[model samples]
Target: MSLHEQLYQWTASQGLDATSARRLRALSGVDDPPGDPWTPLRRGAGALAAGLIGFGLILWVAANWDDFGRAMRFGLLQAALAISLIAAAALRPWRAPLALAAFLTLGGLLAFFGQTYQTGADPWQLFALWAALGLPIAWASRSDLAWTPWALVVATGIGLWMETFGGHSWRFDASTVPVHAIGFVAYGLLCAGLALRPGAASQPWAWRLAVLASVIAISGTALGGLIARDVAPQFYLGLGVMGVGLVLAWRHSEVYAMSALALSVDTLLVVGLARWMSKERLDVGGYFLIALVACGLLAGSVTLILGRLRDAEARA
Candidate 1:
């Protein structure tokens, strides 16, 4: 059908008045949306291919791990790292992907060497070394992908360090309360640095990962305190860190920062309610009333936050 006939039929089917129909036709007649969306898709596909190649190399090493002698294994890993680095340098615009591959391959080499030599070094030592070694590559690449892995490496090192000294597994407990508090505060500071530093404007992943890590640490410590019913001093430290983060987020007018702050606040409220419930004896009716109140509070809080977010978006 002709373009005008199609528009007429569409407007007639929708029962639109002449004025609205005219407006719609005028809007539709404007130039098509700008920019090449395929650019991102191509970049994403390239990164994915690089990641798959890296993972495939790891799998190959794993499959043939027992078959190779120590010298052979070391040679193979070193060769892989060298190849990836060379490819990264030669790949021009795809340098980020190959650089990331080389960075990850270095970790694999470290892990293999540690296993082969049976080093008595703590697990954190390996991760710390990995992060330290990767730092130069991340700086050279200046890619968010490189920064993401760097953040994860640092977080893993801190977590392993906490677990070893705090005498706790991955879970939070009285023994690990201080560790969680320290992690929460440290990561929150790191996030603030990432967000505010003059040199970090290009590294978007830094703030995102830092904020996520801080939230996890804060929520873990807070919830662990509620579960243990200890309410230790470290729990207060977490709260203090969260308060700082909240204020920073508000001052900066950042969406993710605000969301993370809201989440931590909600966690504190929920934990407090749980602790209070543990101390009280409630009949069925009383329990129902408490539940209703909690629900109402949650709903109201969510609505208010969402409205504020809308306002912020509009201003932006």
Candidate 2:
């Protein structure tokens, strides 16, 4: 039986008066009101409306590009931004839609300024500034709808900045491996920090995106090593990611946190098979036997992790 049911039964068995029993039930939440099913639908509708408004504004500006003077264009964007912010303030408790609209308009304003002025600034600098400027609106709204896209924009800006000004190129060769590997670690750590930030539990997408980004970064380094035929680095990188997954799964008890573990396990299996096939030069029959064994191990590990994931999902 559920905890509420058990509590109700125990309270009744104690021969308590009806009023006292009811009070006990209410205090224990056994008599809680039913949840409103329309809440999620309302939230979804608000988000859709916000998106449509933003898109329509963009299209309108594009269609009137040639007819509008520079002052008119800038004035229109500024007025839109001002109106959205005011609406957000007036809405108070129901502010997410207007807040999101304000941020989207902010992006358009930045884009317009960039196109018109030709600032000669790096792309990342613009994005970084945009994200930085949007922070107040996001925090003020206190909605994942605001923060999720904001976080992604910031991540993009940081990634590009690292690529351009951080003295690195996208080559998987030996000369670039160390630099890229370090970059990946740095990026992964930043994502992890976001994932572990306070209040992230309510904004699950924030943490999930962070975890996915971190896994991708670590996987890139591992794949780079594999492509370079450096088995040692490949193996170690996979191991490290797997270890991190274990810690997150164990401590945080999050279902999505185990993705890196599963990925690393698969990578190790592939790397092991490739190494055996290349170095040992095994006969066809031996290769088949090893493949079967490896597949079996992979299947077992997957089943175990899936079981743990289910438990985590339930607990979460």
Candidate 3:
């Protein structure tokens, strides 16, 4: 139970009078009243307005591309970017949403510049540059509103780089093991860095994105290795990373992360079993067996997670 609930129970058990209960609450500060509920609604509205404005600008540019001159297009994008930055700087309360607007505008500007000038740069280079340039806005905003999208930009750049230039031939074999390992390591480091930041517990969206991205990457590569029957080094690395992530999440009582990691492991196991059945040329019964095993795994995972949560709450 929450501290406030515990305090209420204590006051009730003691049959405290109204003034005594008020004094106790004041002394403990555990029963402090809620803040303005409209604050969250206002923030949500601002973010939605920023997103709509960005999308509207993009749609307008697309619709008028043929009618507008090249200079007009460039001028319009630059003006929007400039206005967003100025608004972000001038309005402290709206800094987060405005910074997000500026971040999106900057990306659009970069893409337009590259397209118009034919920079001869790879797609990943554009995303990398966009992420690098937008880092200051995210830092200045100090909000998940900017950081989550920034994390997505970084993940996209990494994915494009891996696909285009990692020299892996899109196969999960010994040759691609190192590339897969490096990618997972990079994502792991990003997740760790975000999680280690001061007050990161309060601002979790960025780190959660990092974790989800890493889990998807590792799970894909590991499943590929299992299906190919090569069992590359990265497969083991992925398992190890997942194990570590699960342990850390369990210790910290992070239900989301724990659920994701567990689900990834379950998927890998189910796929591995299917592959084995295929190799063995098992009959249709094998499919039923696999289904049963999948259900069992899922049930066990849920039970363990719930049990852990209950244990943590009990300890608290």
Candidate 4:
């Protein structure tokens, strides 16, 4: 536990008066050496600048596509990629932003290649390749500034692959196998994020993004099952995975994960109830009932999560 937390616990346990506790806190020097307030602003500015530069490069290429020959286009992208990578290696402080530039340039290069050659490959293939190639940059940067974007790229690739291979239908058929594949992929990402060392700069945001993607994927598949003629296996599997995730997150005192899982459960419950009501000739009373149940669930979930947070803070 942190020093401030220990001090608070000690004071509470000892039943110290307000003045005495204040004196003890002052003596502890926990409040000494105020940190730089500009750090967050600087980081945010750097990330924004990098994003703008990457996006501007893409737009410039697109706008001048007719003017530039094939060689010029490829040369421009390749040159940008090389320059970004070289600068990242040379400048330690600018590593994350430069790596991000390289990651974006790599994507642009692959996209131009596919367009130029007419590879006839699916869009997901391009994104997958981009993600695979960018993994090294993310690993080298060791920052969420890189990992978060990589995670997003991976999620987009998975979604596109699902759309291309799984089709739009949610029915329990051979084509829907890709839905289960996606669930497995989501679970894999969640597990990998959880396994990372928690003390790293990238850990918290990376894991949170993984959990978010997992929750969205599972919830979407499970909801689709509600519309299927026969229940899909993904429905049961997704619920089971969510149950396990909830238990693991609770054990680790991850309130964000718990809240996300609980919200998903609440959504499924409310939607399922509404579907059942529609089947039974639902009326105004039924609508009111659904609204009431939703409200209750929301309230209960909020209370439970807040209580858990309080308990965790007290323990800390």
Candidate 5:
């Protein structure tokens, strides 16, 4: 009937003598026995863990130091970063720290170069160093758990590079600024996959990053129109912008879809205005009207298709 009676009956059912049962009851009294929990097994495990982490970090630094003198070892955080990257690639356990290490190293390398330019000291070496760090940053981000930060940095790098190219002349000897700006756009697309991970972290930072990336990507296109004079006489730049927006709409939601729709509408209105402007006597208004109608039909068709799919699933 009562918990104590129930426990007594249970102990009696075990065929314990009265004295043995009473001793067992006393052992399980209100407080459990307190003692040091560090058995030989637990002590050995903690020691091993500490040793492995320390050893791995030490070896990682040793592998990446360049052929520089004692005066420069303090600055070899680059090499230290390289060491982290090397460990991430070679050791599966190091993947967890790969993102943090890669970001710090790449950003430090960038700052080092940017600083030289600012200091009016060793600009050539700065450029050379920046170039050298690029390879490892790319490689480091490719590993597990490190991809998101990698992608974000690459996107920002591209944006910075794009903004730089739009201003400078003969930015690169091989080609023009447009060539380098394209790298930024390409990097943004490649890193979009990293956006998916933040949803798992439950931290709003990941989603914030995704929104930031989209803004960066959109800005690059606007910058494209400024540097490159490559639009068709018969076509409009907004068409290209709208097309990009639609591609984004198909991939993700939020502001991207709305932006795409708004841009598409704006392009149509521009096409109409071009007709009034009279483009070689072509019917711009008619063409734009036709495109607008076509887009509306496509949207209705998609709705119908998705509705049917939902209905079928519900029946099942």
Candidate 6:
């Protein structure tokens, strides 16, 4: 081949053929490749902005905490926390479900009990908060991940909160029983629905969520006992067992991870509060000790498996 022809052929082999280069240039006019070169800075800026907003809100709440009753202050704190976590969750790059979980779980935990801690807030106040907060949570995001557990926890928390304030009457005739019952049933149903649907409480804890529903279903009498101390103290034991099981199964699912708290509160109420009520007949050492051992082992195993699954999911 002539030297000039050889030079032209070599240029073609180098991928700088004018036609191909022209095509690439044309594509750029319409599409900007796979990613934005400036995305990281923007994301960082957004994250920083969120952090600042959250920190400022918290500081403002703290400054005003004294103006509210202990309970109201805590309630406000909870509402803020739920909103902030949700805001952060919305801004997250991935796994919005975890954020949903945070908002739902924390929102439920704080908002429900926030009333008891408040000296002045009525029983209906928390309900109002639930109605208020739950509406937005259920509405604002299309995310089931955060809201499902959020709703469930809120339901259970409210159920118990109402029962606590209602004073364990178990009159069954009182307005409290039926009102709390309907609410609990709805909350439980919502939680179960969220769990049953896809992408909410994925495996390991999926069973855990299912287990929580079962615990509630079985705790019918115990739920009553919370209001009036009507049933056997054994009710507390059952309540504790369920709490321990839930904690073992889903404690890792939460930030504060107070599966132990439920167990502690219920068991204390069962053994301590009930004891204080009158006769103080506290036996069952042998039975609960065995249950304690068995439950501890179960919780540990579930935790290990859940951690592994979370890791696997992250890797995948």
Sort by lDDT, top down from the best: 3, 4, 1, 2, 6, 5
* Model 3, total clashes: 0
TM-score of 1: 0.79
Q: After superposition, how far is residue 302 of candidate 3 from its true place, in Å?
A: 1.7
Report the poorest 10 consecutive residues by lDDT, candidate 5.
229-238
Error of 1 at 21 (Å): 20
TM-score order, best first, reads 3, 4, 1, 2, 5, 6
For residues 168-274, could you state the per-residue lDDT of candidate 3 as single tens digits? 25676677766777777777777887788756888899989988988898787787777665556666667777888889899999898999999998887788788
Tens-digit lDDT string for candidate 4 (39-124): 66776777888899988988898899899998998999999999999999999988888888888888889988998999999988
Please give the distance, in angstroms, between residue 283's alpha carbon in candidate 2 and its true position after superposition.
7.5
CA displacement after TM-score superposition, residue 231 of candidate 2 (Å): 6.1
For model 1, how does the per-residue alpha-carbon lDDT over 224-284 read when each residue is reduced to its tens digit?
A: 6656646665556666777777777666666677777777776677667756776878678
Model 3 superposed RMSD (Cα): 4.8
Question: TM-scores across all candidates?
Answer: 0.79, 0.74, 0.84, 0.84, 0.39, 0.36
C-alpha lDDT of residue 151 in model 5: 46
lDDT of every predicted structure (CA atoms): 0.75, 0.72, 0.85, 0.79, 0.49, 0.50
Displacement of residue 185 (Cα, Å) in model 1 is 3.0
Tell me the lDDT of candidate 3: 0.85
Better of 3 and 5 by lDDT: 3
Stretches of model 3 off by over 4 angstroms after superposition: 1-35, 229-233
Best model per lDDT: 3
RMSD of each: 5.7, 6.4, 4.8, 4.6, 17.2, 16.3
Q: Which runs in model 6 stand beyond 4 Å of their true positions?
A: 1-52, 60-124, 131-133, 138-140, 144-149, 168-184, 196-198, 201-316
Model 6 clash pairs are: 71-117, 71-118, 100-146, 101-146, 104-150, 167-227, 168-227, 168-228, 169-227, 169-228
Cα displacement (Å) at residue 315, model 3: 3.2
Q: Put down candidate 5 lDDT per residue, 6-121, tens digits, no spaces.
A: 66887879988888777557655623576667654553453355346545654665675555454464456567667766765776644445544654566565665565457653
